[model samples]
Target chain A: MKDRITGLFYILAVILLTTIHSIELYIGFFVLLSVLSGKDFIPVMKKTFVAVALFNGVITLAYILIKGFDYGYIALINLRVIDMTFMTFLFVRRVNLFRLFEFSSILTYLLVISYSQILLFKRYYTEFILALKSRSIKTPGLAERYGFLRSATGFFIEKSVKNSSEISLAMKSRGFFMD
Target chain B: MIELKDVSFSYQGRKAVENITFSVQKGEKVVILGINGSGKSTILKIINALLFPQEGTYRYRGEIITPKKMKDREFVRKFRKEVVLLFQNPDTMIFNPTVFDEIAFGLRQLGEKDIKEKVHYWADKLGIFHLLDRSPFELSGGEKQKVCLAALLSLEPEVLLLDEPTANLDPRSTGWLIDFLYQLDITVVTTTHNLGIALELGERGLVLSENHRLIYDGNLSEFLKDREKLLEANLIHIHRHRHDDMEHRHYHIHDDFS
Candidate 1:
């Protein structure tokens, strides 16, 4: 099954459960998930635990002060905890990192809108390099130019490849993996 | 002892390493030196169990290491407890927010309790106590390496494998790393393109050729003394020779040890 579909099911299930049941049931489901799954989501688990506890504490205190120890605010806060927790967990675990690259599909529109900005950056760099080379005016230095080209190409290729791979892995490890 | 007997590893068609044989007893600091395309990193990966050899055997203690053996989560978990690889790049190995979290990462993975105390102990030991709350990305290169080393040491692995540790560091940082390794009591297998760093950290050196073959294995100081041998191995450079002068033989940049 696709992870996104599974994630969607989890989200819908959490909402339905919280809507029908109480806050304790929601916390029970969370503890169950943490115990069953591999413990790779500790960061999110810690955050969820703290956030849920604080939310419940604040809501209960406000309810006691305003409504005289009534359980009315409990249901509202419980539903919220369920919805937010399920959505955040699924989003962190199921979404692919490169989904951010979907923005590239709008490149044509972006190019049209930012045409002047792009040209200004390109022209400024080109003119600066040309001026620097002109100042050092040495005619046919084949060996030196070849060495420079080799090192420059190697450096750029190494840097780009390293950056791309590092970003991809970082995204995946942070729970940005597709089903 | 750790032994790689007649081990070979191949890619799609080309061989990355072939028929390599070596061993290291407990508490030995071994350095593998090779040029850019010489499969030094591949050897490190093999030792790390990230890559299994295509043929022959890898024996840790007495039992042979194979895919089937490593497939056991219990065994793999135990093996990881004993040996750990420190990657070439700190940014890849460290992904936590603060220096403390980065050091705590491996210990947490191992399911060790009392994480806060362990983290603080290693942080203070490595002199990175002040930087515990600071983000790892903000620290300098030397600080990053120290923090990573502190993280690795917190696990107390018997064998620590380092890959090109000093490749892009300044001389001062490199020297500090060398001194740090010298004081450790674990078995060390480090690969280096830097001859100076290799000589400083290792008592035994293994030189590898471009073809991924072991070319030389011997003492570090004697290896450094041989100019012709170093030149033949593509390790001799002008700066190293000038510093070999009598008055400047010892590499002591800092007198105060700060």
Candidate 2:
């Protein structure tokens, strides 16, 4: 029940923030990443932050000089860089790299956060089911329950296979597992 | 062969592992034994290229192992496919939804085209074919461990680095794991607190001390038989039955820092 509730909260948070603006949404997203991956990658995060800060400053300055900061597009791009840099730094200071990347593969990190979200949901449902079973609820229909289970299972299996292949390809492209 | 020379790693100016040097020849089953906080897992991490040493060198197959070489994409992809590390926690390693995909993960990481056939072969070998469609997270600890083993073994890695693989496993599961490991021809480096499994499966043992330093490296039986020495190293105790006296001789674990 707690996990399911928390999962719902996570979805709501994402929805709420993303609706505000791209910059606010980016900040929220990266903050979550920092909290998740800040530990093991602290040193890496520090280095990445410094590099990204320099990169962001340069890019912002160039945009201001050429196109001016009056337009929102440049600010959005700058906001993204700033958000990523801040999150990377926080992540370096806080989370272990191994723990941060614990659930990711090269591909999983890219092309959709759905894989992680679905995993989180599956775990939520499993806990919910166990709790429900513990309460000794009267079964209305065995076939209906079985059908629900089968569909839930199919959903998980489909996502997992697709995500694994996607992550493998992404890792390969990023020079992971390329011996 | 894999070799680490003068490796040192420090976090926030505090050393985790320092001046460590070790070598494992091809096909050698080396067991690393140590008490908690002894840097045993840290050593494995360095070898797997998960952590870079602040000093010294790590060489694999006579060539230096570096991020530059690893960044080549081809080298790392090949290395990971050939030498895989099995983490202590199966929950961490078994990410796929089912046993089949979980076992196929490492193989697929290596770009194996015929994944279905390879997955079947490994599943059958590990005796988990019936559980193929079952969710990996739902499996028991022993089953999860088997799934993890099947996943790594399917890759056919030449060097298998296991960090306390048998830890928290049931006696039956531990026995099965020991038997499976003994049958493998690949080089196996395992860090374990289980003396029984170590004695049965490992021919050589290396003891890591509280200082995160190597204390002893030699024969498993001979090492286990020395109660006084082992106790000093904070290692597990093992009992031997004397045929002449019909009495059990206990080799007590040593307590370090005395």
Candidate No. with top TM-score: 2
lDDT tens readout by residue for model 1, B1-258: 789888888866688887888898899999988777677877887786767789878888776888797777676767776777776765445455678877876676677899999999989987899999998867877788788788878888889988788875787777777888899999999988777567777889887776777777889778777766666556654432243554333222121122
Residue B193 of model 2: what lDDT?
A: 66
- Model 2 TM-score is 0.58
> Local error of candidate 1 at B65, Å?
1.8
DockQ of 1: 0.02
The CAPRI-style docking tier of model 1 reads incorrect
- Candidate 2 residue A154 C-alpha distance from true site, Å: 17
Q: Candidate 1: where is the Cα deviation over 4 Å?
A: A1-179, B225-232, B237-258
Which ten contiguous residues of candidate 1 chain A have the minimum total lDDT?
A131-140
TM-score of each: 0.55, 0.58
Residue B213 error for model 2, in Å? 0.5
lDDT (tens digit, per residue) of candidate 1 on A10-125: 66876676565556665666666666445546766666667678777787788878878556456657656745674566455655423432346454333443454446445444
The numbered model that scores best in DockQ is 2
